[model samples]
Target: MTTPIVAFLFLLLPVASLAAGPGGVPLRSAEVDITDQASLQRGARLFVNYCLSCHSARYMRYSQMGKGLGLTDDQVQDNLMFAADKIAQPMDVAMSLGDAKRWFGNPPPDLSVVARSRGADWLYTYMLTFYKDDDPARPYGVNNLVFKDVGMPDVLWELRGIQVPVYGEAGDAHGAETAAIADLALQTPGLRTPAEFSRDMRDLVNFLVFVGEPAQAKRHRVGLWVLAFIILFFIVSYALYREYWKDVH
Candidate 1:
């Protein structure tokens, strides 16, 4: 009984660590489902079109992604390959390091493990909360809700639409002073409706999570089987122990 309790507590450790957000801001739950092939495909397409130019997932191979997402080689080449030349190649960006530094003030970090480094919820909220910037010298005219004064521009602005920050009564503490985003209003309509955009972001985050650990789904399946075997073996051993003890009694 004590051993089971200890095992249960150990399982809860990872969940407890991820419960709090940075600066105590609540991170939205990503609720990623790696088995959802359609969502992964949509995320892959979105990533290739909007994010691939700047960010590289060099650790991920296009063929591996196709297999994981249930995409055919032809489909991946047609839809998920924008700047890349072939389906067998790694996900490399066309932008040079010097060019990226000059354009964005710093090189965009590789996103192969970003989903693992930053929780899915944080990534989801970070991508969805880009509001129009108040500053003039800022090239992108937008900033993030989660990451204040973020250097990267809002690349999905056209798809998600422009957002304006709404300020509450001054000194509300959760206002701009704390870099807290009180609220955001849609300033201009985008290609997708609000609901559609949210779904798109969710899908994108899901794909990023999958990319971070391509074998995650398989690992989970294997883990379940292993757990079942352990339980079955334990039950059989206990029964045998009882039978052996009955003779002695």
Candidate 2:
């Protein structure tokens, strides 16, 4: 019992670590709903349009994604198959690893299981936290509150627009006056309103969560059936046992 408890605690360690953003900032709620097929469809479109250029979801095949998202084969081929020729092909990028490494300093990591490794809240916060910084050293001229000095540019900038950090005075360890980011202000509005952008991000995160475990919904349904069967079997077994022992009694 103690061993099982210890193992369970160990498993929770990673989850606990993921709760905080950079500088121990608490992560915002993602509010993802994997069961929302319409949201998943919108997210799939967003992913293909924006994220697919840099990242690959190679663990998942186009055909599989289509089936999971309730998209037909033709729709997948016409819309989401920009990088792949066949529907059965995985969501691989056209860019080579060497090119990606040279361009981005490091190759963008595959996002097939990113939602599992990094929780939906983390991803959602990271997406919304990017703010403009005029630091010449930074490649993208942008930084994230969740991940400072992030290499990846804000791909959704066109939709979310330019945001600048508002700073406030704070005391450091040595009691010296210092500046800290108090909040983010949108310097320029984008194609989508803040509310719309947030909704889009939630949808994207939802789809990513689905991608992490495509069979999760099915698994849940199956588990419920299994539990029901066990209950029914126990009732029948107990009734038979009582009936057999009645003569002896």
Candidate 3:
């Protein structure tokens, strides 16, 4: 029984690795500039336009988004909010999990904690790594370097264009893996260039960061006071310790 169980576990390893895709890269810290209101605003717009179709930020409220992005209730209602939205209600997309699973084979997961779950850099890299792969089994026929053979379609492919992998010697001593975008081409030339595209990704990541911890801004603001108190406590404790040591000496 133990031998069979071990064998089964070994079999799962490759499948798990494949599930992780090319580099088995997970999400990591990103240099997303959340302080930039314009960038955050742009990210909010892009998220509603592109991502809201499939994914939902169930943890966030529409009113919270409006407040964070400096938009009025009217603006959020007119432009960003979809469905029979109530300002106090959590911002959930209309797509049901069952319908999503039926359509995409895997239900799109809630993205409220995506930044927390995958980190900023992973999301950033995943967004940029979609390349063309003519696999019928794949809904998008696209592969990602970070997520590997992901089931989700590359919805931004038109704006980012197709990418092709640049491979190195399979079992080389260095074991290097590299890929580059073919011709730096985009299916449609947008207002943004490659650098700008990276910036856009950063912005989207910022919104995710915001969603991950709604109180993060407040927490950070309070952290300084906490740190100062801790420092003072440590200093007082050290002084008491020194006095005791001196008396003993």
Which candidate number has the best lDDT?
Answer: 2
lDDT of 1 by residue, 1-249 (tens): 358646744663545345456666677778899899999999998999889989999878999999999978998888788877878899999999999999889799999888877879999989888999879877778887788778898989899999999875545545545444578899999999999999999999998998889545566689789777876776677679878998898
Q: In candidate 2, what are the lDDT values of residues 54-150, reduced to their tens digit?
A: 9999878999999989999999999878888999998888889999989999789999888877789999999999999899998989999988888
In angstroms, the error of model 1 at 242 is 41
Tens-digit lDDT track for model 3 on 1-249? 356445644653533322232444444345887677777788888898889888888878888888888889888888877653688778778888889989988788889888765667778878877777666866677887777678788887666656666553455357665443232234445456767777778888888887777755555679768766765676677678878899788
Candidates' TM-scores?
0.75, 0.79, 0.68
lDDT of 1: 0.84
In model 2, which regions exceed 4 Å deviation? 1-18, 173-175, 215-249
Clashes by residue pair, model 2: none
CA deviation > 4 Å runs, candidate 3? 1-29, 173-191, 215-249
lDDT score of residue 228 within candidate 2: 69
Report the lDDT of model 1 for residue 91. Answer: 94
lDDT value, residue 245 of candidate 2? 93
Residue pairs whose backbone atoms clash in candidate 3: 21-148
Q: State residue 55's C-alpha deviation in candidate 3, in Å.
A: 0.7
